[model samples]
Target: MAGVTAAVSARLKADEARRPGFYAAGSGPLPQVRGSTLPVMELALQITLIVTSVLVVLLVLLHVQRRILLTMTGLASALRNSG
Candidate 1:
């Protein structure tokens, strides 16, 4: 089994080396700087949070307005009955 694995690995190495523009560096490729992506993603998340908060505030305001209107109408009818 080990011999078969070794043969397969050798074949893969040979095939990879034959490809165009292939160069083997000692330290390999440089590490990607993903620091920029973090801030951009954070900004997007913040914007979404702000928009969601605004919508929630608007919904609460509308609900309060509806309740106030119902209460005022009830009060007006009671006054009319008493008068």
Candidate 2:
């Protein structure tokens, strides 16, 4: 079983190396750092987080506005009926 597993692993590694930009470095099975790719990945992650945060804030504000409008509407109706 071990021998078969090793054979398959080796074949997979060979296939991965054949692809473009497959950098295998360090003492691990994966690349530790491939040129300037890490920074690009970080930037992408940051941008995604910022976009998500802004959307959440906007949605919360909209909900608050809707609740305020509903409360005002109820108060106005009560005042009219009282008079």
Candidate 3:
């Protein structure tokens, strides 16, 4: 109902007002690092993630059929052993 929505909105507003940091516009508190270390660390993490994702995609593409066959064989072996 509209009344419930209004109450929820009011509660959220009060909560936000009570915690300014919680609704901060910028990235939450920066780590205690010297000079540009923080940005460098963040960039490193981003690059690592991108490279990892690309490698994973390439690996999957290169072994799609082999992976599928191995998965099915493993599943069948598991089922057979379970009986």
lDDT of each: 0.81, 0.84, 0.79
Query: Per-residue lDDT for 1-83 in model 3, tens only?
Result: 99999898777767865773355234466445456566888999999999999999998887997888999999999999999
Best by TM-score: 2
TM-score of 2: 0.57
TM-score of each: 0.54, 0.57, 0.38
Residue-by-residue lDDT tens digits, candidate 2, 1-83: 99999898787778767886674343256645557677898999999999999999999999999999999999999999999
lDDT tens string, model 1, 1-83?
Answer: 99999898777767656774443343377445655586789999999999999999999999999999999999999999999
Q: How much lDDT does candidate 3 score?
A: 0.79
Clashing pairs in 2: none
Off by over 4 Å in 1: 1-35
**Which ten residues in a row are the worst by lDDT in model 3?**
20-29
Q: Which residue pairs clash within candidate 3?
A: none
Model 2, 15: alpha-carbon shift in Å? 17
> How many clashes (backbone N, Cα, C below 3 Å) per candidate?
0, 0, 0
Better candidate by lDDT, 1 or 2: 2
RMSD of each: 7.4, 3.7, 12.6
